[model samples]
Target chain A: MLILIVEDEKELALSIRDYLKGIQDITCDLAPNFSKAVELTELYSYDCLIVDLGLPDGDGLEIIKKVKTEDAQTGIIIISARDTLDDRLKGLNIGADDYLTKPFHLSELQARIASVLRRIRFDGKSILKEGVLEVDTVQRKIKVNGKEPDLTKSEFNILEYLITNKNKVVTKASIAEHILGEYSDMYSSYDFVYTHIKNLRKKLVELGCPDYIKTVYGTGYIFETA
Target chain B: MNLLTKTSLLITTVALTVLMAGGVIFFLSTKEMINKQVDKELISEMHFVMRSFDNLVHGRDTVFYEELTIIPTDEIISPVARFRDTIRLNVFDNKYHTYRALFFGFRKGGNNYKIEIFKSLIDSNTLIERVTLVWIGMSLFLIVAIYFLNKLIFKSTWKDFFEILKLAKSYDLKKPHKKVLLKESEINEFASLNTVITQLLERVERDFNNQKELTANTSHELQTPLSIIRMKAELLLQTPDLTSEQVRLISDILATTDRLSRLNKSLLTISKIENNQFRETEKISLHEKIRSLAGQFKELIDEKGLKISMTLEETTIEIHPLLADLLLVNLLGNAILHNPVENGRILLELKNNILKIANTGDHIELDKENIFHRYFRQSKNPGSTGIGLSIVKKICEYYDIDLDYRYRNNLHTFILDLSSLYTS
Candidate 1:
């Protein structure tokens, strides 16, 4: 997948590109200004565009509009420091696929990108199979060796999250956010995340699958199929 | 008293006093003029009588008086007269009326002849009385007319003033409104009042906005660098064969960066809320909203071994749905975080437009006043962002919703009364 990150902040944009490359097999480009971003979008076909609402040259929401006017199918994600509901809604209304506030976990951005790509390219059914583990996106079910396991809604969500982003280090915060929605802000500790992941791993291993969850010592957990 | 009432009272008193004084002066002046006229008439009549008497004595004038007295004593060589006011009998009307009489002593033909002549002063007296009465009546009329005219003119003249006063009274500094100036009147004072007040309000709003901008920008500008620091620490933690002390330091750095991110986000949230940035609202079912939010806490609640109950009815309310959700989440999280060590009980109820969330716990010993302030942490963990309740309080204030915290019987309850919430 080819992606363009339209952000002026050099370090943040570089980190985001490096993080994405480390986690997934994808090529990324950076545009430092509105004109350059527009020029790049014209010069090459992109699978997705990461647009920042605060650009030094111009308002990036207008860029979303301009880009969508030319190519309506380019998946756009808005990464902004403006977190108001109005700003989020405006971006979404203007053909942006998702919205993420700044100072966010790169893993959260990765999950959003994957979701947006699946939505735009696959047109709905997003299934994943790694070794003997499989997730049916349409049925919201998980199967091991063609046998389904009894998983609750949150358990299912967590499994799908880890399996899709296999081999990528996902933070505990990102996992909580992915499963709990906005209620993730209420977490005072990650003990709940540890318990949920332990239960999910037990359920999977009991159904005759190898242990695939790896903890990165001081950091969060990583789902490894390699 | 109010300005209008006080002015009317003062004006009436002054006008009445002046009218009374003028009436008294007018009556006295008119009485003196009438007396002088009466004295002049009496003198003229005495002269005429003396002339007629002289004529009769010389045998050249016919005189009606047939009786005369002569005295040869020498009291005066010329005529000496005295005048006295007396009431005499009127032969025509048979009613005694006031009269001015002139008595003169003189020597005629070497003998002193005394003549007493009296004329009626009834007509002059009646004229003086009538003139005094008319003056009093006119003075009273002028006083009443002036009072009414002053009242009517005052009300019409201050119409613009009252309008500007009303606008000032209703103006709120917190929620600024546009078009603060009234329609400019032709009067200079009223127009000046409108201009100054509008300019003052605009200045206040601009200054408030600038301060809010500073807060928002400062918080927003900190996010990128904090993210960089946090991500770098995260990347460093990824390297292999690091010592325990090294891991500890890098993780500490990561933890501090995370805390900073949360702090900055909270500050941004507060500024946005106060700036009236979140304006989207919808009709949301309290039951469904509560259920969905509570379900999100299922894992934590279960892991903590806490019990929560809900007695909710599906009442729909109009509010910013996101804020309503946030309010519920914060309150419930507070309940769980503050619950006792074991067997904690939480009871939630929504009845009669009041949302009551009661939890079983020891009294938190919160300062009733500063509990809602930013960075007020009661727990010893020192990890609490300490801004959750403050944000909830702000949201409640925005909606004019009444929020109260109380502890009794070791049960801390947060009550939100939604019935009295007003939109306008």
Candidate 2:
């Protein structure tokens, strides 16, 4: 899946790209400011969009609005250092699917991406099937070839979201907001999302499901059927 | 009550009293002196008349008697009966008297003679009387003039005082231009007071703004590194064929980053609360809000296997919704985190604008006074940042909500009095 990150902070943006790259087969486009983000939004089609509230030319909310207007189908997530509940609510109210406070773990981000994809693709469906592996979104259940498989909720959601998105790249911010919810914007914290994702991945491997979630370095995740 | 009015009243009252007393005393003393002088002159004139009688009877010397009559009697008796120009005379004698004295060619006699003398006094007394009247009138006028002058001075200064008060009422730390324009007072006391107030207000505004800016800048600065750490950890986790120890190490890094982020957020929240920066106000249902928060934290509560019971009253209150949400989140989060396993239980009750949350926990010895202080942690709980209750306390103070904490029988209870919320 293709994901676009619009942030002015070069180091942080590059790091986010690299983190998502480690997740799965995903392509990333980076925009440093509002003008660049607008240019990219107008030029390319992305499965998901990650935006920062503070931009050099304009506010990130405006960009999110523009992107939504351009591509109503594209999922938007706001990644900002503004961790206030009001900021989060405002972003969400403006049609951004989720909000990630700054300083989020990449694994958590991946998990969030998986969850958003699951919600967007499956709506409220309980079971998500991709080839031989099937994930139960609601009961946190997993199965491989119709056999019961052990998987934590985090793992199941991640696998389910990726499988739903299939070949689409999901950004780190999308994953973070989905798993951590409003608290994902906290820059120095990643424990909740990271620990859950680690446990989920471990359980998924133990359950003998083929590891389809691939990482693209410096970008995000992609679920490919081999 | 004001300074000028008070002073003017005091001066006018004292001056009127003194002037009236002095005027009465002068009038009485002048009258006594005139009466004494008149008696002395009359007695002298009687002697002169007796001396002239021998001349008149024996030698027929009328000029001597006439000269005695011309001797000034005005010093002894007033010549005017009214406040205008007029002159008149009269003489009386005892029935046994053989001769009498008269003026203007008239003779009257029989026993001893008695005479009354008067002359037009308008010309002589007019200037003195007018001068005295004018002096008294001027004194009264001076009293009123001084009183009003003082009032005028005080009114201007008092206006400045009111202006200062008004400026203080609307003082905004965020906007320094909103500060009052202080005028220099002619009164030393008022000027000094104004100076002190202005200085204090300026210092408070500066300190508050500095603290706010510091929190915002620090939070922003901290974000970049945290993001970098999180991203690096994700990159490491994505490495193919990572050993267990490596995975654990990466996971540990991620956890540390998460903790740091939480800490940063909490610190920022505390600063915001302290500065009273979050001013958004809304009407919210207290019971419904608490229930929603409880639902959100259900995963944590269930993980601890704690049974929760609630008794909520249907009431709506106006407050900053974020503050209310934070208050509940911290309290519930703390209860869940500190609850004893297995048979742990949490009971929440809301009624009469009061909210109570009680949870079963290990016995704790704490200094109640210090519990709400920032960075104060109880001896047994090392996981707490010590700012949760502090934040709650700040919210309560800002909203005028009352909060109390108590522990009894292995149950920790937090009571919040929300009466102010209802009133507001």
Candidate 3:
């Protein structure tokens, strides 16, 4: 999938590009200004656009509007430093697919992008299959060898987030956020994460599945299908 | 007293004092002049009676002698005349009338004879009394007239002042309001007062806007660098050949960056809240909000082996939904975070529109004064951002909820008086 990243900050843009470069299907094009973004969008069609609201030349909302007017099918994500509800609502109202505030985890961003892409491309029904595991995104069900395992809502969310960023280290903080939403910071200890992951591993292992989830000591857990 | 009443009272008092003094002086002076006129008339009557006696003796003039008297004395008195006041019965009116009398000795027909001439002072005394009565009446009228007139003038003159007071009383810094215009005043003092007030309000507004912009810019400027650092650290952790020490260091970097980001976000939230951006409100049930929050934190609570007992009533509050959520989250989060690790107790009670969250924690009391201040950390826990309670306090203040903390029986209790929500 060809995507465009429009951000004025050079280092942040490069980091996002480098991070997404690890994904097999994502090809990112960077634009440092609003004019360049508009120029690129006019020159070539893209699968998605990551637009920053505060650009040096003009507003990123203009690009979102232009793209939306031209092709309503193209997904657009707004990454803004403004975390106000008004801005979030406005961006969503302007046909943007998702909104992420600045200082977001790159893995979280990747997961959101994947979700947005899945939504726009598949029209809701999407499934994932690994060696012995299958995930029905629409049904929120996980299967191993055609047998489903009982998973709680939080565990299911965590599994989806891990699987979406499969083969990459996902922090405990990100998983906590995924499960608990914005109030995840209220947890003084991440021992709950440890327990959920342990239960998940046990359930999967009991289903005759190999241990695909690896612990990166001092960092987080990574789901590896490699 | 208010300015108008006090000024009127002062004017009345001064007028009463001056008028009373003038009335007394006027009465005394008019009486003195009347007495002097009576004395002059008495002396003239004495002269006229003496001339009449001489004329009668010399056969020259005839004058009325009703007010005159003649008395014979054995010895000749001094030729000088003596005048005095006396009261005598009069045959004409059958009433005792005060008289101004003069007695003199003169030789007539070779014998010493004394002439006594007196005039009645009844008219003069009556005139003096009448003049005094009039003076008293006029003085009272003038005093009352000046008092009421001064009151009327003061009320009209202070209209601009009262308007300024109303403007100041109605001005609220947090709420958006109409432009405050000071009406033009004919009084120089009130005009200058309006000018000063306007300048002061402008300065306060300017400072407020500057602080708001600073907060916005600071947060905006900080987020990008923080994200870059976090991304770099995450990328470094992804390196295949990195040792355990390197990964740990990168994780540490990421953790600090995350903490900084959270801190910045909290400050921004505080600034936004103070700027009154979240003015929209809705009805929210505390029982449901608490139950949901507890359910979300159930895993953490269970993992810590803590017991949470909730005794929530059917309490509802009118507040901004987002603030309501944050207030409960922060309070509940603080309770859970500070509770003892094993066998800790948390009691959540909402009775009489007051929420009390008591938890088993440290044996000591936290600083009550500075507890709600930003960055006041009560513990050395690495995960405690020290801003959660501050956010709770800010939300409580926004809603006019009274918050108090007490430490008793090894339980740190945070009492939130949510009764204000209902009253408003």
* Clashes by residue pair, model 3: none
* Docking quality (DockQ) for each candidate: 0.40, 0.24, 0.63
Candidate 3 chain B minimal-lDDT segment of 10 residues: B56-65
Best by DockQ: 3
Ranking by lDDT: 3, 1, 2
Candidate 1, residue B67: CA error in Å?
Answer: 18
What DockQ was computed for model 1? 0.40
Model 2 / residue B52 / CA error / Å: 28
User: Model 3: runs farther than 4 Å from truth?
Assistant: A43-45, A68-74, A120-130, A133-136, A144-147, A206-210, A224-226, B52-123, B178-188, B243-245, B279-290, B305-320, B342-373, B376-424
lDDT of 2 by residue, A134-220 (tens): 777667777777777665555566566566555544444446555435533322222344445557556555667666666543245
- State which candidate, 2 or 3, has the greater lDDT: 3
Scored against the native two-chain complex, candidate 2 gets a DockQ of: 0.24
Give me the candidate number with maximum lDDT: 3
Winner by lDDT between candidate 2 and candidate 1: 1
Task: For model 1 chain B, give the 10-residue run with minimal summed lDDT.
Answer: B61-70
Q: For each of the candidates, what fraction of the native contacts does it recover?
A: 0.43, 0.41, 0.72
What tens digits encode model 2's per-residue C-alpha lDDT throughout B1-424? 9666678888888888887888777666654554445445544654454456555445332333312333322233332221211232323321221112222211224222223223323322454466568768977897888788778876776876777777677776544545567777767877888899889987897788887789867976887888787777766665666666776676667666756766777888877776667777889999999898787665456556789999999978988877888888888877877787779999999999999999998777457899899888774554566777887887887777889988988889999999988943
